[model samples]
Target chain A: MVNAVTTGADAKVSVRNLEIAYGDATALSGVDLDIRENEIFGVIGPANAGKTSFLKALNRMDMFNPEMKVGGDIHFSGRNTRGLRNVYALRRRIGVVFPLPVGLPMNVYDNVALAPRLGGQRNRAELDVIVERCLRRAALWDEVKDRLDTLGSLLSGGQQQRLTIARALSQQPEVLMLDEFSIAVDPVTTMRIEDVLKQLREEMTIILVTNLVQQARRLADRTAFFLDGRCVEIGVTEDLFTGEVRDQRTRDYVEGRFG
Target chain B: MSRSSVTDFDRRNRDWYIDRLVQAVVFIGGISAIVFIIGIFVFITREGFSFIATEFDVSGFFLSQNWRPTSESNPTYGILALVAGTASVTGLAMLVAIPFSLGAAIFIAEFATGRVREVLKILVELLAAIPSVVWGFIGLSIMNPLIIEWFNVPVGLNVLNAGIILGLMAAPIMTSIAEDALKAVPDRYREAAEAMGATRWQVIAKVVLPAAKNGLLGAVLLGVGRGFGETMAVLMATGHSVNIPTSIFDSVRALTATIAAELGETAVGSPHYQALFTIGIFLFAITFVINLTADLIVRGIRNK
Candidate 1:
């Protein structure tokens, strides 16, 4: 297994030789990755490319499903995350936004404050700060602040997605992963979300999965293209987009010859 | 031209297909059943509503403490005691059944392991299959004696006995329906909760339960309605008292039992007969209201 540990480097996430299997099929095999603090990293791939699986393995969300099997080392802030048995603590450090806008049945305020409250922040003042601050960070506070008590499901689709992002941000996680967050929203909302992602990367390490190449080109500092569960190529976003003449597969994908 | 030309035998053969025949039968059968159920309700309301008056001294008849419908000069028919008794006992049964059923449902849905959960689910289904009459028999033969002797209760056949039997009957239904509700919750919601660093129990209590609240409320309302309308078990174990139930251990009569018991003995056109018919109407109306409330709760949950 490959191990890359740099001294004095404040990498928020360092995953080495990470392997994940679902029942008999191997979803990810011996993947090594690193995410520096305040950098937006995007995973670009077609369907069944193990992008979601890798994201899930980062926060140990797959453990809840009975059919998943995971292996290998994941390190967060110098601690081996594989040895971290507490899924709750692991999740607290790394927040995740699912593909669908799964707004809880509760009010918008509760949806954002749920993580903080579960993490033991109970006072009203602190909750109000977190809810407003996170919603503002998601760029949704102006629209939803007045109607905080309204049910989350009552919100429009784009607002619901932003609310979900705000909910994830309320945890104040060290790293945030979004799994195809813009697939369901309109083009204008997607651009707005991309803007929010750019702002969020200044404070939190962000890993995003998207099929849209331009979204990755716009927001991601580094982009990794995956072809059939393997990382095809990863480099600076501009290099991958402009000077990617080495890998023909990446070239084919970028040129839209084949996905 | 062949015998099976495109416009001739082929079209006739296509019309005789099994799928079309089956679809026709299913459509007709479903509509027929719906019509039959509506017809039953209409017939019951038509027959029962004729004897009911718009206004009367129902306060005395319903709110009275005693029910003595006799053939004497003053025929006393007070259903208030029975209605009150049914309400109290059914309320107690709901309180007992809800927690136990919800707890068991949460366990089966979220916590229980493979074989254990399957076994528990089967046992719950078995509990539902046990007839209400059998539950009454068990209440009489086993439950009542145990409550009286071991628990040192005053009497065997009382509101407590009926409540216990009704609670037992309602538990399985509530648990099964609540389990289905909990199961209906998409896995993504639970994952989202867990990813928020929520413990398993916390996920169940906070996220899962709130999401399935509508279904759970529906289950509870259904259980309450079932307990309210239960005739056989309440008739058997409630000791058939006409007095208002003073306590859990007091004997009482329910509206269903009152109708069941007096229908055969009373004269068809007498005031007593008419009052019993009115009691039938009242029972129907009470259950209808409870069911309507349950429907509203389910709809409210959906709106949420």
Candidate 2:
């Protein structure tokens, strides 16, 4: 356990003593954190620092891998995730965006409409409204409105990344988790998506896992520094940079001395 | 010194000679397939030519059911009944094979894992390796008695018995190919769909199946080809009666069986022998078309 500043009552997600392992190799362990509701929580770490593994554990993705073992408790809202009978219902409330854009092998309209359809929304008019609003919120509607029937994979890399954001938003989730969302986007597109994330913070709690240290500074209300499979420090985003940090490693990593 | 080094580098070694020899051997092996196919086609054409050019009546050969090649007087070679028998049996075989193989493929590819998956894969391969004659034997000894007892049909060996045997025979290979097709779909697509909260069934139905449709179609066509080309099982199980089948219980004859059964007894230059060769040509063309179509459909996935 690391950060004890936030209480469990206000936290959107409370994870305690979480551990993840694949076969014999442990990827992450002893992680404790509280993500407040409607706050942009940034997680910064280098490659293989278990940032991606942490997000995967949040949604119980270990079920797909027979060799992956997960232990300890993760509470979403107030209910314990491990005790839930239907994992699909739990996943529906938490949206995820991968590092590289995954524009499902479908048309743009259908891609954005997939999650809602999975949830049993069959009305065409309702689907149309949801698709438009999600795409618009991701800043992609105007660019793709004329050619909604084209394959989503045919779009430019930057556009596809935005399209992925639109797809994640389509679920209308309570928590939106993005893993290195801007790794494949241009600087300008990255800034544009950053603005969209800032706006999204008002509606949902956003967990942004980023490699860019400055990105955490720009948007996160509070940030947690992960190092070598452990959460090193958690504090106000500005305080971590300007004020004193408890761990020297957090300052060294944030200052770009070493990963 | 620089010139000497360049000359040494350019000199061919023993490895280069071995490489050339292996390439030449593989080239001959590759080209022999076309050579043998053409050779077989020419020989069959020559053997069947006299009957085709002289006595072959287009309408009677295709539309009439009479195949009395052994008659002392009228010796007609109409094969309508044979065509119908082959068509019916193959059609029924496909009906049984498609679902069984596709379901097995879905289980092996999507559901089964670790030791279970490995065991299932080996079992399927073993099933594919079983001799057609053994399947024919089972149809003769086992399925024949079972079908007669269950359905109370007069004939034990008939279209249904042969069709079921052929379908079971075709399923393992079809399952193997369909599994390969399903496996070809990238894991990322599955991961993405799973992350979106789609249930296991929903992920397969909505994403995986649509992506693998072409390959699945190819697998079915290959099974149809196998059913068409199969002879020993059809001969032993179908009772080899020369008739146009009306129902599943009706015993029937197939084109390949006719060639295999009669070619041994007919005199070399007799019209009876030539007529059998004509049936051979027809069987060859149909199987060729089916196999080529399967190949093309499977290739379509790679291009995309």
Candidate 3:
């Protein structure tokens, strides 16, 4: 059920019939989603709806766990992701923000510099520039520039999340995936993150996964409602939020009658 | 005003009392253990410090190659030979233990499947269970002969044999500790490295190893301490020569082996007896310094 005009419109990431299983249980069942370039896409669902699993598959993290098996077509920049056995290279093109901050135990500067340094840029000046730019983009430079040498674990929770985002940004990924980015953060910080996401969408594609429907409506250019490992509906954010609802389940869910 | 109300409140208060009891017991036990450890250290230093005056001709004792305490003409007991022998053997053992243990640790921490890792971990733990005396016996019977025959060595009991046995002994410890260190490295670090287009080997070499460098360094030093303090294996494997051995095949005596071997024959109040005690003090000092250095390195890595 692909929309005629919007189905393949400048998509940077395309997943089709994506099925993932861990032993006897299935995490995702024939899920398909298209992510457009330079757009903030939101995936809204209750817990266990495979939102994080979907984010992980985009970067081949499901393969890291030997027990989990993924069967599907994930196309990135017109190439089949499965064919690219180089997990590092694939991940470089797509970065992830875990639910928690998950900052490395290193200094903030090193945390930001790590990806670029490992990606083969050895010049100190170049790294310095990249770190500053990323931290600035993440809106963390003001608070952290003075304490770049301080261990990342010493930062406040919201600052740590921003620093993690900055660390991800230093890789210069084409698609940035945030899995419950604001779940551990306060509402004031959440608003700041939404602003950062808005600015970030101008530079790269972003996929925001959250259960907060209002948050999805606020930041996403397009939103997909997921339930039970399947997309119930996907469309332009405004249309999806305000337009006539068809499916009774979708209507009930959108109206906050049920999940 | 009802009996039910009083009963419910008492039940709530009961849980609080239980929690307080647990906390009190744990706090007292932990503090008492710590105080006991400190007291032991203080007592040892106070009792042993008299003989170990920092000004006691330590240069020759550490550097000289002589090993005779009794002579018809003149008696001398320079501990240099024993210290050097111990150093050489422990150094070689560490060299062997570091690579093998780190390799095994990395394999278990990163590459092995869950079931395989469990099996490997159990095997490592079993290795730790084998008695040091058994290792000494094995080295004496099986390994000493092999070295003598295979290498055509003049003495089967040599540094090489002792070092090999010590390395084997130290591996399980290094492997286990290093595995823990590697495991302590956050998965996010590995993820970031991978996201940067680094290969698995690269991720380990650059990110995982550096992050765990402090822990790995501590593990290695602990292994070295194990090799250094090893008494039975060295006594059985080494030929207990007083003279400094140039080659791995030449016989040598470590401080621990000397103490174990000579304590029975030497008179209690003799100079030889005091000298052995001196050697024990020296070994203790060496381990203390090594552990201290390890602690410093671990702190440095953590605070970096």
Which residue pairs show collisions in model 1? B62-B80
Cα lDDT tens digits for candidate 2, A125-191: 9999999999999999999999999998899988999998998899999999999999899999899
Per-model clash counts, in order, read 1, 0, 0
At residue B164, what lDDT does model 3 achieve?
86
Q: Give the range where candidate 3 chain B is weakest over 10 consecutive residues by summed lDDT.
A: B47-56
Ranking by TM-score: 2, 1, 3
Q: Candidate 3 lDDT, tens digit per residue, A58-82?
A: 8888666776788978778666787
Candidate 3, TM-score of its B chain: 0.84
Interface RMSD of each: 0.9, 0.7, 2.1
TM-scores for every candidate against the unseen true structure: 0.91, 0.96, 0.86
Per-residue lDDT tens digits for candidate 1, residues B243-265, read: 67778888888888888888889
Q: Highest DockQ: which candidate?
A: 2
True contacts kept of each: 0.85, 0.62, 0.57
For model 2, the superposed segments whose C-alpha errors exceed 4 Å read: A1-7, B1-4
Query: What's the CA RMSD for each of the models?
Result: 3.2, 2.4, 4.5
DockQ order, best first, reads 2, 1, 3
